[model samples]
Target: MDHLACFTPGDLQSARAPDLSSYHWRLLAQGDSWFSNATAKLNAHANLLQELVLKEKACVVNCAGTGEALAHMVDLESAPDFVRLLSSPEAPVWDGVLLSVGGNDLIAAAQTPAHTADGKEVPLHLRLLRRQTEWGPPSAGVARYFSEPGWATYADYLRSNVRHLLTLRDQGPSAAKPVFMHCYAVPMPRPAGSEDGGLGSSGPWLYPALKAYALPGADWAAISRLMVFHLAQLLKAMAADKAQFPGLHVFDSTAVPLALATPGSSGNSGDWHNEIHLNHSGSFKIARAWSEHIQNVLAPPAPVGKQR
Candidate 1:
């Protein structure tokens, strides 16, 4: 397990509100339609809460995921509209807010493919397509990845959406509570004849220190680095906006970040499916990491003592 998983929800027991288990956790997972994933994690997290219920405890309730949650926000609408969608004081007041939005935004930025309502073929970003592994630098092909019809609009949308979410995080009574924000999907191996973009697809770009991504022949190590790159952008953005949102505290999900996805590595962080979402083991690991993140926030920083 990654060191991040070592954390446990210690003092959050006290932070529990009345019937918190019944409290709603409005999860907003954008990009590539990852609702099932959001719901699944919500279920897994809910199980933990269910156990707490017997102890007369409670946790956040969960909303549906994918575009359903964020549809209103990203609906080719105005920025204020997005803000209104997010910060509105609605029923089942949200306690914990989890987001996985930017992956789609980046995908849009990358100008990837689009299928018609009837599943007809549409143009996909040629930059992403690979006839060989030795493909290099930005080019007409690369333009598809870095540029698109809605690229500029999508980038603007992302910036605004992020700002709105942060503002909302500081709005409600549960403002100071936990906000579990997931980063964008890392590029990984995309199975041939499949476009789920879950795991195992290599990334769009790979720079040495700044970032890295899986390649055609990449081992696990390379894949893991890409995952971190995707995730890091979100974390870094949140940290940058800290001053704007004092009530919020961002979790470095990429903390103790995966070195690489080599088989039998100390941390099995990345290496599974390459894209954004994790596999069974990976999801649990992330859930555990989130639990720990919540624990860290509710409690004082622990002393890093030598464990006997």
Candidate 2:
């Protein structure tokens, strides 16, 4: 297989051929709010995947949602029933399984209310304490004000979710077919405070990328590394459990050395949009990572001809 180096999300979808529209592959996509942008892109990619795989009848099923939503994918409403669902495979459980999860779990777990010194509430301060992030990069969230210990808890949740997904992958798939996923993207950070006294305006839209506060007491640098650690751990676990999941396909989209290593905050910048949702370019950036990973998993070198 030759190497594929550069691409944006648009290039991925736009590059498809008319003949590429017929492949059908069963797919399920899910992620927290951070992945909302990528979800659409992944669906488009799935269409492409389906088209390519169509010589052998298949279709993609997009299961995009928040972590809160993912818990329910297996009917979490009934914990016991959900457990049963995990224990058994139902219809359309064949072919391929594409996932984008864990981000929502991080977001969901990170959400907590802030309190005053006397246990009273401060609206502005509470917002900070809650870490009420709106996606983009962690550029504008309340990371700075957060203490080292609290951030560590958030890190635990991130790692736990990845482990959980791997267990599911090993159990559900027939052990032969590939289960693919990417390392969720990290939000670009802004200078500690960039809004009305550091937090800027709580605008519905993120025009000027937010620059949040960097509190002295918090563990700023280490926080970002934690996400990568979880991703690495996930990959390592999968790699080590060779027999458990023989063909687990994963791509390290966690850090972009090729593009947007330094995400900009003005005029659409480079890759990020708002902090979480990626622009077409950003999505493609990830898609490019995905494409190469898929190429290796499905084929060392994908032929121009249809993939059955």
Which candidate wins on TM-score?
A: 2
Candidate 1, TM-score vs. the true structure?
A: 0.50
Residue 57, candidate 2: C-alpha displacement in angstroms: 9.2
The sequence of per-residue lDDT tens digits that candidate 1 reaches over residues 268-300 is 235233233344445444455555565555444
- C-alpha lDDT of candidate 2 relative to the true structure: 0.42
Off by over 4 Å in 1: 1-56, 65-95, 111-156, 169-171, 175-178, 184-187, 192-231, 255-276, 301-308
lDDT (10s digit) by residue, model 2, range 175-226: 3567676666665443211121222222212112122322322343244445
